[model samples]
Target chain A: MAQFMDVHHGMKGITADQLREAHQADLAIEKDEGVHFEKAWADPESGTVYCLSEAPSAEAVQRIHERAGHRADEVVPVPLTV
Target chain B: MAQFMDVHHGMKGITADQLREAHQADLAIEKDEGVHFEKAWADPESGTVYCLSEAPSAEAVQRIHERAGHRADEVVPVPLTV
Candidate 1:
């Protein structure tokens, strides 16, 4: 499985509770796409959120996010990790 | 200390060798700013790079990247992570 790091913008004023809820939303249906959301980080101040996941492709990551109601602004393949 | 996720854009066609070298450059001088780069991921096609680190502030991460020669385009404080 390939790991991905996706960025979400325009989520300004999102609280910690909201972040968690959104994360859960993705997790709930991630398995349907053979995706596993491993970790998420948020900067509420900048309305920027980052999610790390293992999936078949970047599209899979996007689908999960979009279905969760917060489409990611950018989804990049992280082929190299260190 | 806080964790940060920074992105670097516009480095298209970066090879594995180049990415490794760049990561080494940051690791070499990261201590000067009391920063530790935990990991880095890159997508040569998108010319986008994401770096995860533990630092006192986003500025510290930026300083290390700038001194190492590839300044990050965006640095967001990851106050909440899960």
Candidate 2:
């Protein structure tokens, strides 16, 4: 599985709690898409959300986000580390 | 300027202090590249670093990170919000 870091925007006033709820909800169903959401981070002040996942493709990550009701604005494969 | 989210990996065991130092160092010179890094997040256990910036292009973002000595693994434009 490839690793991907996806971004979501336009959530300027979201709370951390809300983000946690949404992330948890997504994780509950992401396995169906061959994606495993490993972690999530949100900047409530900026309205940005980020998710790290291991998946077969970026599309699978987007699909999981869409089903979770917070589709990502961008999803790209991470090619290097450190 | 467009918003970009960049990811860096392979830094497992890095401390938040080191990440902050690197981010600050990058900011000190990013203006020359037309990039403004607004914030950064790091997960030491996962060795993943995420940065949010406003720039003309992803290339500018990559350039800034490269100059900072912690090149990003991926840099993608973020197009949506909420």
Candidate 3:
């Protein structure tokens, strides 16, 4: 399994509730894509959100986010974590 | 308390040992700046690294990284997490 970090841009000023709901959207159907979204962090001031997940591929991670109503602007493989 | 995500660029082929060593370097003296580096992720293919930390300010995070020898290219406050 590969770990992925996906970034959502232009979501500035997102509230805590909105962030949770967006994350929940991904979790709702991640299983179909073999993705597990572990956590999401957002900087409301910058309007950016970052999500960390374990998935078969970066595409799988993107797919889950897209289906959840937001598409990730960037998805990078984080093969090394410490 | 705030969560920050910092990015490091131009280290595209960093090895696992190198990554761990770099992280350890930051951990070795993080307390001096009141920063706690929770984890780090690297994408050797893209030569990008992302760090997650709880810090008093983004500057403190950057200071620790700079002192550790790998200055972050970008640092953003991720005050919201889920």
Candidate 4:
């Protein structure tokens, strides 16, 4: 399993709960795409959300986000420590 | 090496070159701490710098940053995708 962290920007100045709901909604899509969300965080000040997930590919990650109605600012692969 | 991303904020509205220099300095510290830097990025508008690195522990990551004379806003573990 490859780890990925997706950084999202321009959340439309949404509230924390609202953002959480969007993320939870996105999580559902991720599950459908065979991705597992290990953890997630949102910065209310910056309206940015960071999500850590395990997925086969970055494309799969983007698909999940697209299906959930949010576009990522950047999606980077996380290499495991040796 | 486990890949971790460090998100930094409040860069005092520094320029990209300045931030990059700071990051390069930080990378030297990481190398000394047995960490390998994969990639790093900075957003001038938000004054955010994100770094990808491989390290055994988050504490080690923090130490590298401190040694470089910068503070991290957040450091989240990236779970490998399964």
Give the C-alpha interface root-mean-square deviation per candidate. Answer: 1.1, 9.2, 0.5, 10.4
TM-score per model over all chains:
0.95, 0.55, 0.97, 0.53
TM-score for candidate 2: 0.55
What Cα-based lDDT does every candidate model obtain?
0.91, 0.79, 0.94, 0.69
Local error of candidate 1 at residue A49 (angstroms): 0.5
- Tens-place lDDT per residue, model 4, B1-82, is 6656678777545665676677678777777778766666554544666776688867788888888888787764443212
Model 3 Cα lDDT, one tens digit per residue, A5-77: 9888899789999999998998999999989999999999999899999999999998889889899999999
What candidate 2 gets wrong by more than 4 Å, as runs, is A1-82
Task: Provide the interface RMSD of candidate 1 in angstroms, 1 decimal place.
Answer: 1.1
lDDT winner between candidates 2 and 3: 3
TM-score of chain A of 3: 0.97
- DockQ value of candidate 1: 0.78
Candidate 2 lDDT over residue span B1-82, tens digit each:
9777787889887776788788888889999989999877666666777787899988889988888899999786654322
State the lDDT of candidate 4 residue by residue for A1-82, as single tens digits: 7877788877545565676677677777777778876666554545667777789887888888888888788776654221
Per-residue lDDT tens digits for candidate 3, residues B1-82, read 7899999989989999999999999999999999999999999999999999999999999999999999999999998999
**DockQ rank, highest first?**
3, 1, 2, 4
Chain B TM-score by candidate, in order shown: 0.96, 0.95, 0.97, 0.82
lDDT per residue for candidate 1 within B1-27, as digits (tens), equals 999999989989888888899999999
Best by DockQ: 3
| Docking level for model 4 | incorrect
Those runs of model 4 whose alpha carbons end farther than 4 Å from true positions after fitting are B1-5, B8-82
